[model samples]
Target: MKKFLLVFPFLSLFFYAGAQNKNLTMQDAMLNARTTLAPENLSQIQFVYGTEQYVYAKRSGNDVTWLTGDFKNKEEKNLLTLVELNQKLKAAGRTELKAMPVVQFNQGADWILNIQGEKVAYNPAKGSFTTLIDAATAAKGNVEQSKAGYTAYLDHFNLFVANVADAKQVTQDGSSDIVYASSVHRDEFGIAKGTFWSNSGKVLAFYRMDQSMVADYPIIDWTSIPAKNVNIKYPMAGQKSHHVTVGVYNAVTGTVVYLKTGEPAEQYLTNIAWSPDDKYIYIAVLNRGQNHMKLDQYDAVSGNFVKTLFEEKDEKYVEPLVPMLFLKNDPSKFIWQSNRDGWNHLYLYDVKGKLLKQLTKGAWEVLEVKGFDQKGDNLFYVSTEESPITRNLYVLNVKAAKSRRLTSGFAVHTTQVSTSGQTVIDNYSTPEDPRTILLSEVASGHSKTLLQAKNPLADYNTKASEIFTIKSAGGDPLYCSLYKPVGYDAGKKYPVVVYWYGGSHAQLILNSWNAGAGDYWFRYMAEQGYVVFVMDTHGSDNRGKAFEQSMFRRVGDVQMQDMMTGVDYLKALPYVDADRMGLFGWSFGGFNTVDFMLNHPGVFKAAVAGGPVINWNLYEVMYTERYMDTPQENPEGFAATDLTQKIGNLKGKLLLIHGMQDPVVLQQNTVSLVKSAVDKGVQVDYMIYPGHEHNVLGKDRAHLYQKVTDYFMQNLK
Candidate 1:
């Protein structure tokens, strides 16, 4: 691939010869960046179920008015108003809504909404509402409602099913250690929720995690009087992990049966899916080693092991994130995404696990599988076929095995296909463009720009932003982004602040708004006369498996090498001050910042790391074991990346920050390093947010940024 330096043309909208001059305040940059400083968006923009018309909400005064438009209509019309919607709510004996709740049109032309925690159906024509699922019954979270009007939720740790009239407890043995109807495996393998509702809503499958064998880890709450210890079950690498099982609940008979997975009991059962007919359930069962995975089927009613459809084995690791997407028109066929062939691609399989066809194949990976058309003939998806940093929409003709790009340009696009799949809404953004939404016809590829959002920072003077690629040490292209200081001068050198998260399952640089900085902090620093830089190293996401697996058994080695390649590029620039460079990152990036400063001493003059992982052994079992294996099996690899062991070599000004309540990367990781710094007679600064979690969110986040800025200014600047 040829490399090119592409300066975003859309920057001209915000940067000009003499338009305005305004610098970002700390509060605006950190707290309100996603709100006041964020780009304008169409609220609740979606296709009305089974209709060509799409609706969006626009604020009128204190309330919003719902508006609808279609390709044929071309003119927007009012769909509903707060006053009328409230009248209906009052007539139905419900509390009148002060504001318009997020409403979705159902197949019957009625709207479905979750109002006051209850799933209700509103008939716009009749101006009435019928509660589909009662809110009082759903006292706990993890709520899931089936089409059959049955609701499932977790009360305490036990699973419960309820209808409009009554409720029933499905599990009686649930306790603090024995969890049910909740996410398992620390929410790995893309398991966001535990409840799985079948097509007809006849059966509900949920996860049962037994953590009695795991060790207890304490998270101190300093806010309490004299402080308090909250113990949580945290399974570490090379330690005994929690055992998990699947339970099937029959809504008709009110009986539960557990699947006979049969194993060492510590294996991971991920990607749970129900058959279209609700007769069988499929699970991607991965072993403790994570190198082998079996796609197994079980009878949903009896909980008997049906058969092992197929198995996938990888020398490094076999990770199955997405569940099987069964075809609606043909229940016997399904689409499975895997990286078995070195890239994440879609494979068509029959009920017997026989390969029907490979739906997609290439160097680029499919980022998401949207859904099929009303006829289930064509499939919609998002991928990086255009460029690794850009996500574009594509439509695949399943029968012909052909794909066509429905979206264009080198930008990130998130799409929503219509009910009939004849039209789609593409919401995209570039470094220059904050947001641009287009309504396009999938058949003709003709599109009309629905809205072109004005730059939120257009009135404020901003510097130039560039998105390009650089060659890594191994000659692979590393995507990079740079935000130059305001009023940049070619002859004058300026201090540089490098922000990065060089870890798996994340990408820092993209051809999107603000170069995917995600906040105004980078621009805020640039306005302070510091060049801000970010690079997506080889191990980052959206790249193929080989690119990511290059760091297998050695997490920080390849990432640091690629990051140094970016640093070298910065140092070579005439306007970058090589003598005064600093680093900042959070979580995995925090680990990288500390690792880089220690491993490559004197490279960075100052650094700040938040929630850094000092040792792999202290991290969770599922994520750490996948990348670094168990500590017993790869002690040498673990020893190489351990920052506490290399604290004595630290030469730069280092500040470690942690959220005391962070359960993800426990505060212990940073405290252990603080202890090691004392042992090594090295000076290390530290700060802790008493009530914050892995991330210091809301207004407190501004304080975190202030501390970071002050550290860089006092030490490096």
Candidate 2:
């Protein structure tokens, strides 16, 4: 596998006006830079499997129009060309295109394409189409069909009804923002799965988030008339959060009942699951601080809270409830993940909340719940049992409670099992290996490679990466990888850049082949004579709940200690110059850089802290309260770790950069730190990227990386 920061340092300084012997526009610079950093291959690598067909929008090369495609077939098949499809509708005498086209399957009926705006349903087998609902009526959410089908579409959310004759609206109050029947986060990123649907699809339980109460952080478009502000309802840390309410809707009666939550308005109502019989709803409610969690069962019909299934309290903090299973077809029996036993493990519980068995007992944490097999005898999941830095697939007999590792290798493996649990798609990569995607039989362990990403930088003549294990000051072994420069020589020492993000609940060192934007940037930096190293410090995630919560009350102490040990380990390497080392990070990484630079200045010559949280007081209640407790309760600890107090201790050359409109870490954090440092006569270079946010996205990121490269070359070189 290739390290991320090994490719682009020479391109970083190509922007300097004084060094500008050649004319290079921003576009030219980016195009030239991307040539050195582009991934070797661009192919559809399997990430995960879902119940629905893989539908996504793509750009057409011919006319630069948007087209939708379905990834179910082996070959890429365009569902429709927007222009041609629109022209066909215009010929059919349709004035408007309201809803997009959707695919539906039925046992007796042919495959159908339901087109919005056109209000037409096309049957592929019959070669005929019919208008199901008028465009104006469909826009008003008045469409409905009897429920016995393999798939059914109701307004925005879809469902599979057992009896089409008995089907009705499960939710009545769903709108643009006030959605009740849909999944959260739009089926993108991690939180793609929906809340819950009954075994027979009779009762549909979902989360209705009231984001109207939350403030809309605007993203402005300069091209629009008067520069229209795109208001995004973003819930920042310590700020007013969106109110979440769980609802159990009856599809037969078209009635929606909100589950009774005794807690205050801002509490998080998450991890909702319905019983097999659809009589009761299970929900996990956590306080805004996220320390106290209560799992309650409610009557689906009456909307009355029946009893608390389980209550977990953590001295440090309790994580959001991660539900493993609803016990196959038995809703009364379920599996829940908890760290109350010091390590994150699975606990089987009866409907009455009595602990039935401890399904998984270990020091390591289960990374994913792959669901149970057909027999309901075996449970498959991913875990970091072998090492904290690496992940592998595993299976356990639910009845016998006997566990066995399914994957045997040092590389990090991420697996996604099919709904049947018979087949799995396993993708893995190590520091020295390219990523390989494989299809494997879960029971037999037979596998076939689907795609192997070619090493994109093979032609770049980059040096190899070395993996090492360094023990922290606390005796915990930390896994890290070091990327040597392209022309590394044993006799000549290279300036080291320790890329750090020692935040709780984040893993930096992984043996995955999918390199992100930051990883590519890191690789480019490494190619420029900087030996880049990344370590998963003490407070980082994927170890277990205890290891993750270890930084509570004492935010920077353990992480800094572990990072110092990593620095010491780096200094021992023959190719590293200990005195010429530097650090760079963003967000929590930025926080780590600022904390380390202030507490241990002599170790790093130059440091960059981008969008760092200088004080815990500025952060939000939900996230900050979980790890650090309330600032009032831990004033001493907060003061000790606060970056503002340690700004005067700055001894290294530092550069502070921030996006002017960052909502997560807020640009105010960087501004405050710089102001404090300047007031104390501490010299620090600062840059503000106008209209940027927590991330310098799009073309702005290229410019940001260039600036960072220039900073490192000027100070560390």
Candidate 3:
């Protein structure tokens, strides 16, 4: 990928000429960008990744068919082609038919499909479908099938149990306001997985989230009649949160028991897991502020709190419950990732939350825990031990406490380890290479090429990326990447633009594939007599939790300090004009950019802050509270970090861009900043995309980038 970028000077020139249309509309700009930034089909999906079997609904020879893979092998035979299966049911006197594929049966004999909201067992051999459970009106959670043919679901906000013979609702008190079976907040943005199927699949445990008492944050959509308002029960920073509880349902007896959490409604219950024997449930509970966490166990049947297995406390804030690792061979044993030891490391723990051993200990943080091997002894994870700016795969032995580096090379590797941890699909690139995908062995490190994206911009004449390192005023090393324009000269000084995100849990300077717009925008700026630089500061991602958590309580201070140091570093460069430096960023990056311009106005001549969080007090609780704590507790910190409060000190030509309907960093943030600047008699440029959200999607992004580029050129140049 790096070589392609380096060699494609001509292609870059052609793209630049074609893309540089002054009168182009926002739609046209987006269309042009998409044409250049076409994504590749990697044959990866949510459930079935890298599988030859293509699951699709198609019409075949007068019959609608549902097929998985090539229908050559008997085991790979048709689960059910829609037309034939429906005709057979119609011939059996069942006219109304609706079948949707559910969970894949372990033995691959048949798939559990939903028909009219009821689970049914469809046999390919008999061409028949039998009703396993009766139809219900509410949404059904994933079905759990036991070896004894018992099935269960979270129907009508409560657990429902059934066997091959009959079905019954296990829980009685379930309503729209009181949900018992489904995950709250649509399971996105750090919601824990709800279903807990035992090892034998005979018992099931599920989460019940009650949001009746929580206040709703109204989301107004003008597209609907009378302007529809979606009342999202959002837990904003320092706000009342939803209460979550766990319940165990017996598949054979049709009984349910609610686990006792003892924690108040404001607390969170997450990472719930059931024991192998279905005797106990383990859960991680955190307070509203998210500074303290407790790993608790409960009796599955008796609904009694057993004991506190482990506790983690932080002076700043403890991280919320991420997904936990459970051993397949010994369900009593599990693995945990924590920053209590000052670095994110893996720890082996028993069901009682007793520390069995420390698996991996180092300064590097484990990016992900990608399942255990077949034996459940070795754990596969991605880490940045090689370089803070790069990620690579690693494997650790649970019992031996030994670890091995899986990928050792210059290119940065992001990997997806298979469920068995034997095979990995590694995607990597560097400054000198294009993105190349490889399938490699976890233990042996042998790999085969899968896909190497051709550099479509190879024919464009462009300058190459120059990598450099700078030491901050505090003597901490910061990695920076500089992009020079095509056909450069050393005689004349050029305007320098610093693109930065300088936030906790983020890294911008990386040896990886670059998007066409990003590359073109940077290259174009350089081509137009501007120097482009991106620096990854100390409080960035991939480094362990300590480095990221350094910004706690002082969100914008340390990052700005590092960025100002980078400005000094750039000012020292012979080719960069000290007076012509600009900064731009989106979201958290935008917050940094604006805050820097306001607080340290002398360092930046121009800045563009897009979709910024002007005030921490307005953000959501889960993410904001983790880093800044509750505003009630840290009032001074919140007041000091508020960009709107510091707008009076703005010195730069600032362009404030925002999406009108941005849900993450709401549009009100931009409005507040603009109002503050106006009240202080400060001049600022502003633009808003009407129907856009936090990110300008499709063609809007092109218009956005162009707008940003034009603004920087006009102001900084």
Residue-level lDDT of model 2, residues 271-327, one tens digit each, is: 776677778877777777777888888999989999998898876667754643677
Number of clashes in model 3? 21
User: What's the residue-level lDDT of 359 in candidate 2?
Assistant: 86
On the 0 to 100 scale, the lDDT of residue 64 in model 2 is 27
Rate residue 658 of model 1 by lDDT.
97
Q: List the residue pairs that clash in candidate 1.
A: none
Clashing pairs counted in every model: 0, 25, 21
lDDT score at residue 296, model 2, on the 0-100 scale: 86
RMSD of 3: 6.6
State, as a TM-score between 0 and 1, how close model 1 is to the true structure: 0.97
lDDT of 2 at 213: 66
Candidate 1: list runs displaced more than 4 Å: 1-18, 106-109
lDDT for each candidate structure: 0.88, 0.66, 0.70
What residue runs in model 3 are displaced by over 4 Å at the alpha carbon? 1-42, 45-189, 192-195, 200-204, 224-230, 416-421, 442-444, 515-524, 527-529
